[model samples]
Target: MLTRDEVFAVLQTVPDPEVPVISVVELGVVRDVDITPDGVTVTMTPTYSGCPAMREMEADVKAALLARGVRNVTVRMTLSPAWTTDWIGEEAREKLRRYGIAPPGRADQGGFVTLTRARPAVACPFCGSTDTVLQSEFGSTACKAIHSCRACGSPFDEFKAL
Candidate 1:
């Protein structure tokens, strides 16, 4: 029988398919773990409702747990609480920075909508410069934005705040 802690430990080894530098657990995708006599169930919340990586992430979790000798594995996704960038830990943010992707800043929780809001400058992950310009609102994925650093002339992705 696998303890809850042991299950989580195994999940920590399951890296995110999109962000290989960080585990799915580190990305705050795994919401809860339930162990039963019949099987183990993992509850997950996608970074966004339509995130394309959700299926891959669920498959990886199942495969990882199965490889660990678990007989049955179930992945349940919930969208009620909706994933937030604020769920990302400080250590994970540093890892993203080291991986050349600018980590997201605090998410805006203001309920009001504003069309004239100026976009904040994203710091360059490679050169640590605030003199970065947004090359495109969309990056390799919808969850990230493309930015170019004026200081080092490096193009990098910024994990957009949800």
Candidate 2:
């Protein structure tokens, strides 16, 4: 039987399909790991309710565990608490920056909806400058936005805070 830590170690090897540089664990999606004599269950939360990469992520998690000799593996997803960028650790944030994607800032917890919320200026990942312009509200994915850095004249993606 595999221990919880062992399962997590295996899970850490599974990278997110969208963000290949970071593992699902580093993305803060792997919420819990439960082990039993019969099988292993992994609980996860998607970055959003309708994230397209979630199916791939779940498959990767199960495949990773199965490769480790586990006969049966289960991936359970929960949306009760939802997913937040705040779950992302500082180290993972730095990894995102190194990958040329601006890490998300603190998530807005105002609990009120506004038509137009003032978005903070995101620092450039390449030149480390705050002189960045929002090129588009949508990027390659829904959770990201497109931006251009004035200092480096480079276009990059900014992971939106949720």
Candidate 3:
């Protein structure tokens, strides 16, 4: 049987389906890696409650571990603590910026009380400009918001700080 660290190393090979630039480990979704006598169990939290990529991510995790010669892999989805952009690591944030998607701002500022106040300004990933406008709350994915960079005149997605 593979050790927990060994399983995690293999899991690092699995990339997020939506953002192919970073692995799930970088995305901070793989919460826990448990090794058992039978096999391995991966605990994950979805970016959002109804995120479409969660299913694909789970399958990818399974495939990645199995491809690395580990058998009987299992992925468990948990929402007790919920997912937050704060969980995203620094490396993943840089990757998102390089990919033209604005990395999320402080999660503490953006919460379920959006209607109570204005959303925080999202900086442009390409030009590093704070002058940006919200094009739409919904981007290519529910977890992202569409924003246009005023300085660069470019359209980009802002991963919501949830």
| Candidate 1 segments exceeding 4 Å error | 110-116
**Ten-residue segment with the worst summed lDDT in candidate 3?**
108-117
Give a tens-digit lDDT track for model 2, residues 1-162: 789999999988998898888899999999999898989999999998899999999999989998989999999999968788888899989999999999999888855323268889999999899999999888999888999999989999998888
| Candidate 3 local Cα displacement, residue 111, angstroms | 4.7
The prediction achieving the highest lDDT against the true structure is 1
Report residue 139 deviation for candidate 3 (angstroms): 0.5
lDDT of 1: 0.92
Alpha-carbon deviation at 72 in model 2, angstroms: 0.8
lDDT (tens digit, per residue) of candidate 3 on 1-162: 887788878888899999899899988899998887888899999887888999999999998888887778889999968888888888889999999999888677434736345787888999989899998988898778899988889999988887
lDDT of 3: 0.87
Better of 1 and 2 by TM-score: 2
Comparing candidate 1 with candidate 3, which one achieves the higher lDDT? 1
TM-score of each: 0.95, 0.96, 0.93
Candidate 1 lDDT tens digits, 1-162: 699999999999999899999999999999999999999999999998899999999999999999999999999999968788888999999999999999998888954323345778899999899999998887999889899999999999999887
Q: In model 2, which residue pairs have backbone atoms overlapping below 3 Å?
A: none
lDDT of 2 at 161: 88
Ranking by TM-score: 2, 1, 3
TM for candidate 2 is: 0.96
